[model samples]
Target chain A: MNHKEETIRVVNLETGYNSKKGATVITRGINASLYSGELTCLLGPNGAGKSTLLKTLTAFLSPIKGEIFIEQKPLREYSDAELSKVIGVVLTEKLSLNNMSVEELVGMGRSPYTGFWGRMNENDRMIVDESITLVGIENLKGRMIQTLSDGERQKVMIAKALAQETPIIFLDEPTAFLDYPSKVEIMQLLQRLAREKGKTVFLSTHDLELALQIADKVWLLDKPHGVTIGTPEDLALNDDMSRYFYREGVEFDRESGLFKISHKLDQAVRLIGEGARYNMVKKALARQGIDVVDADDCDVEIETTDNCYIMNGKEVPSIEMLLDMLNLYCK
Target chain B: MNRKTTMLLMLLLCLSIMAFLILNLLLGTVKIPVKDVIDILLGNDVDNRIWTNIVMKSRLPQSLTAAMAGAGLAVSGLLMQTVFRNPLAGPSVLGISSGASLGVACVVLLSGSIGGVALSKLGVIGEVTITLSAIIGSLIIMGLIAFVAQKVKGNVTLLIMGVMIGYIANAIIGVLKFFSAEEDIRAYVIWGLGSFSRVSGGQTTVFIVLMLILLPIAFFLIKTLNLLLLGDSYARNLGLSIKRARLLVIGCSGVLVAVVTAYCGPIVFLGLAVPHICRGLFHTSNHATILPASLLGGASLALLCNLIARLPGFEGALPVNSVTALVGAPVVMWVLFNKRKNEI
Candidate 1:
């Protein structure tokens, strides 16, 4: 009921499902806070209870421990309509709408604010149209939702959330089915929403790279039932990323800013190129047990004179010829 | 469609429905001129007593019954479709109609030996007994479907469960038929043919009153129904109690189906087909328009079928169910096929 500087505060939250056998605790003793004008990405592996936590926060499910407060008041204290006015959720499931224009579907976002008849007044229409333009789907406003592609559908879904005019929006895997480009676009849209609209945007994503690139703060769910919340760079610099994705062979390389797996290759190969093409060739060579070295390295040599070439006192013609020359010279 | 054009079309549809009702009153096995039919309806003393009896007793109730059954069935269908979130869902699909049929079969075919009086004795007591039994049967089946619908989240699974329930009701009806006497069986068979004329003047009042009570409840729940189309979780997020909304929808739909069946003997296809037509006409899923549109559409379609059922020069009136299937099946098929191609 109190709306003083609205924020989502979670204290010592423990969430998981239980059966007769025992409780399978996901995340325990978690304390987190999300405020306006920020985009928070909840990053974790599959089955790490990211969705469970999101659902609990949205009041879809109750947590086993601690309480969540929106605007310093307990979440349970707010009625469903009141909560809806504050929190708008975008789920990963497909909506069950057919033959409805983009405008009509987006208008449903204003349902909580509408009267019992669900009629859209002029203000409601303006909000819906503004949401469509916010998502940059104004041209497709008249198109049927069924005809839109997955990426477009996702944008429309977000637009629907925006139409709700809620201060806090929670999206579960907003880019789950989108390609790399679409993923970046969606994340950027969420970022813009947070920054420009002064709304709090919370999303769970498996796209770790995109999340790291765009999120203002990352809620990293790691093993041993712990979570670390900070800026993406802060989490990366603190080496928290390694703990979250702890597998046997894979390692997070801080220098390359990417994940790498240990390889058992004996030979290294030299290649000539620059930029993305060179990186692509290096990756291709790595898969074949041939690591790429810079062309300027002194230890590597290029035999140009195929019919009469010598390198390190060895003559080579073709690659086959080089093999023959190495065989003869070694003998 | 533009708003004005759509409103105009709807008005014209209403007019056509009214015209069909007038035609149904005038034409029968013994033909009467349009002028005399109008005069008789205005309470004029006519020379032909038989004509008056036929028009007032047989023709008038038949037409009104058809319209009511149509409206009731169509609204029932619309509610089922929206609640289940499946376009194919209807009273027949959920076995509610079959339950009503089973109740009728039992009372008319099997319960005659208990007393000298038949089930269709045409009194307050007989009518009340039949109506209550039908309602009880429909409620039982509706309750079962509602229970399963909650547990199983998928629309396909829910539809399959409804069909299975209908099959079970049919099996029970077959068993009851097997045990019934020849005369009682004949009577049940005639009822199974389905006619709107079975509803007398007394039954018409009961039918209208029940409809008035139930239809408004459906309209009042339109907001919840609209939220439901977004799915349960979304509805919950919108502050609707999902369980309560589902119960209300099922209860209202059950009452609609039960009353129509009790009086009209399972008028088929209207409930299954009319909502799709309404949706097609309106081109919107918002229940604010779709619900009332479906009610009026259903009433109109029923009146149309009633007029067709009593086409002049026929030896006897065609079964109302047969007429509805003839008309409704094609519309349903078109909706299904069109949706498949368009991926709606």
Candidate 2:
């Protein structure tokens, strides 16, 4: 899946904080390579050292052992100024600039390239305009950053990074506090950016299903596992995806390649239907801790059609009515 | 608006400075005519020696002192607020003024306790001692803050530390005052009251020249200040050296406050409120615009306050500190209310 050239490579890396006693290594011996023109998602549970890894990768924190190479140069070698031109970052902190216009905010990305006075030249202004247009925020160019919604602010940040024109972009939980559609939209935008712009887009996220759907490459990070890198389908096919995320009540459904909550099967119903309607009835029944099966031993039979569910020879207008009929008849 | 309009506004503000400066000279306790004031300024021999002496010796220098002190304090306040990212941050917020006062207290109270020589009687030597002591005190506090800023990560923490240091200095000043004579205490209290006409002749020249030099140097920080407004992480990511930048800004601001407080007796409000007024007027935090705008606005406001303080009815110029507070408090309140209304 990684057909493009590798932009960043991590080898035998150890990342964590340094205490007075000794090094507190969160995760060790991590080997990973991020290629250009790919969207990589670093998926992990809480306290899985995702942020530590991100911080280490961005050179914010020093790695205890091993080395990281950015564009074949040692990450430690590039000066902050040189590295900035190569790798842009978007952090999770809320920006406090209240009176700054979106255009000015994005124009700040030209800092490393601008002169001592930081006055933007024509080329810089054109790049800023292009980045804003790329993020589809041209209408918001004149608006203040404080007036924007969280989603729009995130987009503006992305535009800022885009204006930086770096080969790689690293974001720390960019979709964390956004609404559902906003999360999906941001993920999709990042995915498209990586694919179209040939950037090595790396982000750490808690959104499992969104990442699975959008990421070109997924890095499953766990404390014990260290790092597992591959495409989403490959990780799913090799059964590497299920081992780490496994919990008591959650099961990875291999058929659809998604995680589903494993419900109790104390109550049973034989679901008889096909297509979308049957799936809806099965899902509704599962919510009530009722199991759906094809066996005749079940007491209640739910036969679903295009818009209605028939249970026990009585036609129910909706899933709600079907649940009510099941409660009355099955008991 | 565009850069041209921004420049025009700055020019308009400069014009306001000139207008206020002239008004401050003309409208004082003696009520010198505009013609006499202009003639005196043009180096012409005025008919009345008393009017000439009053206009040249006192009014002109006092007006210049007030304008420079206001501009310096306001610029320093802008730097502190931007660096600390706290709206309420000012030169005094970091206790730099207390540092200066502490220095003055040490000299005044110690002299009174040891030799019975009042602060007003120390002559030229006493004035020089006060200036040197004030500079030393503020520099020591600023140096401590710069050292702590290196060790600490948060600006808020540094701010609190500065406040604590100020409290410590104030506590020492209180103890010194308790042991001193009544005349010494009265002198200290009057100094605390603040005045713009305190400096004249050689001292006034030194104060104005130092501020002129420092103000231009502060302009060199325009780029750094703009970067700083992006906050620490982003500023660092943009190749700014956060520790070094913080130290430079804090050092510049500390020196500005030190110089102004030494000359003007801890004048308030101009430093704390002028930046906010500029921000509200321009509706942008870009230091390129805000810096010059603050400088001009502060000068104009200070000149206006000086004029009001020296109105024909008031005896010995109604205390400047009270006038600044009475006038500046409303502007601050209005800006805060408008900012809240805009939800900025």
Kindly report the docking quality category of candidate 2: medium
* Candidate 2, superposed: residue stretches over 4 Å from native: A1-3, B335-344
By lDDT, the best candidate is 2
Off by over 4 Å in 1: A1-6, A18-24, A247-251, A260-265, A269-284, A292-331, B121-128, B143-168, B341-344
Report fnat for all candidates as fractions from 0 to 1. 0.52, 0.52
Interface C-alpha RMSD after superposing true interface residues, each candidate, one decimal: 2.0, 2.0
* Per-candidate DockQ vs. reference: 0.47, 0.59
Whole-model Cα lDDT of every candidate shown, in order: 0.80, 0.89
> Which number leads on TM-score?
2
What lDDT tens digits, residue by residue, belong to model 1 across residues B29-123? Answer: 78888877887899998889888888888888778777777888888899999888888788778888888877877777667765656766656
| Clash pairs detected, candidate 1 | B73-B271
TM match of model 1 to true structure: 0.88
